[model samples]
Target: MRTKVAIIGAGPSGLLLGQLLARAGIDNIVLERRTPDYVLSRIRAGVLEQGMVDLLDEAGVGARLHREGLVHEGFALSFGGAGHRIDLKRLSGGKVVTVYGQTEVTKDLMEARAAAGLTTIYEAESVTLIDWETSSPRVRWVKDGLAQELTCDFIAGCDGFHGVSRATVPSTAIRNFERVYPFGWLGILSETPPVDHELIYVNHPDGFALCSMRNPMLSRYYVQCRFDDKVDDWSDERFWDALKSRLHGEAAERLVTGPSIEKSIAPLRSFVAEPMRFGNLFLAGDAAHIVPPTGAKGLNLAASDVRYLSSALIEHYDTGSAAALDRYSEQALARVWKAERFSWWMTSILHRFPETGGFGQRIQQAELDYLVGSEAAMTALAENYVGLPY
Candidate 1:
């Protein structure tokens, strides 16, 4: 088989890239190692920046999102057991965010691709690329216990952080930066109504807790945990008690508890690899960088990469010019580093430290106090939360 562009992974980045390339009349093929059902239900990031929403709408993959999405004007910050709201619309000159899960976005794009007759193959395993130096890049793979190969004008590796594409790049040519936090987040999806009007990120002496939502009946919440803590260790009662402590004095009726449908322990970390492009292979999304999730910038960064990469690929095919392609790495990294820094800063301030011996606790309190007292600080946080432009 052959295509103009061979995309690896059927996640939001790859699928969105395929949609954009199709709009540009660039034929492409997408291969994902997982089943379609798994990809459609990968429960991940839910906050969408103004720019991300625009991209989805322009790409014609946001109909369901527009109809079912929750639009938030701002979020809340709670510290010293008090809540303060940051009016994002006022702070960002009318810019806002949308609450839609990554899984739903992927589902939207997948459905759109199917309707448009785009080529997306699922459960295609052991995928690899060969012959990059030739006029076309070749993707070789095995699917259903059979061997297969494909040729394409360029290869896009959006297979995420643990995929084979990153390993394909020579280790000598890659530069990595990483920071592992002492804490992790124990996230849960509960069948309960949200406790707050908007998302609430609370900082307390115990740790950090976030009150978010998936819909009117589904509440999403997370609490800081030690790195080695297991999800099984957090019973429903224990989880509710921790939330109660963090949200002390808040109405118990508002803190509705319900059965947890999903739970996971995510380590807080920041990782970035420079030069996102390697020969004919380009890495996007989690394959290139990872944010701490405090700023909710992971999916947004992936979408940003898709924007730049798709434009470059379209230019290359239409004008036969490699200028944009040549600048891909240098361009993607600029935005990647900005998100990395912001995520790190947010994670540091919001999470409690095990080594802090009381002094560190005071520092966190001071920062939160400053954020509430100073309009300039609140504005800065509000802008980052609403998102900076792509």
Candidate 2:
């Protein structure tokens, strides 16, 4: 079998790319190592940049998002006992972010792909990119112990950081930049109402904590933990207690506690693989870059990557010009580096560092004080938070 393009992952980035390309009359096939249920089971980013929301709409899958997504105009940034509000909509010229889970986005795209009869192969094992350097690229995999292969014009490596897409490249051909944080996020999902309508980011002596949500009845919360921490180390009661200690004033008083339905520890890291294009194989989303999640840029970055890639591919097919395709890496990296800087900045300001000591903590608080007091500083934060222009 053969196709115009072969997608190596069924995650949001891959699905979004496939949907957009299909809408443009470009034939593409999506291959995933996990089942559909497994994909949706992974809980991820709960915020969307306006550009990403618009991209989903362009793909014809934004109806549910519009109906169910909670739109936020601002969020609370707390240091010490005081909470300062950053008016995202006001500071960013009425720009707003939608509080929608990444899981839901995947579900919507999956349903849309099924309805449109797009080709998506779930549980495809041992997928490999073959002859990607040559004009005719091929993808080979196994299903039910049977080998399958497809020859394609292009190979999209959307699999993820651990995926074969990026790993397939020779070490000498790629340059990698990575920073692994000393801490991880111990997060829990509870079936209780959120403490506040808007999300709250806390910087306290204990550590960094974030109050986020999925819906009215479901709350997502996170507190920084040691790098070696495990899921079993945090019980529901212990997690809630730790969360309450970090929160202050009304936020702590109004907080509602309940049984945790899901719990996990995610290590913080900032990574990027330079020059996202490897011959005929183009890497998009987590397969290309990763953010600390402090600035909520993970999913947004993926969506933006897909945006550039789809446009480039569409241009190539429509006009038979490879100029846009050739410049895909340089263009994508320009934006990727900016997002990386913002994410790194957010993490530095909001989290406790062992090496920083007391003097460093004072400096961090001083920076936050200046950030809230100055209009220019607030606007910069708001701009990055709502997302910079694609």
Top candidate on TM-score is 2
Which lDDT tens digits does candidate 2 get at residues 1-390?
899999999999999999999999999999999999999999998799999999999999999999999999999999989899999999999999999999999999999999999999999999988999999999999999999999999999999999999999999999999999999999999999999999999999999999999999999999999999999998898999999999988899999999999999999999999889999999999999999999899999999999999999999999999998999999899999999999999999999999999999999999999999999999999999999898
TM-score between candidate 2 and the true structure:
0.99
Candidate 1 ranges with C-alpha deviation above 4 Å = 251-253
State in Å the error of residue 300, model 1: 0.5
The all-Cα superposition gives candidate 1 an RMSD in Å to the true structure of 1.2
TM-scores of the candidates are 0.97, 0.99
lDDT of 2 at 78: 92
Global Cα lDDT for candidate 1: 0.88
Model 2, residue 197: distance off in Å is 0.5
* Model 1 residue 143 lDDT score: 85
Off by over 4 Å in 2: none
lDDT of 1 by residue, 87-188 (tens): 999888888899988888998999999999999988898887786646688988888899999988788999999887777887898998888899899999
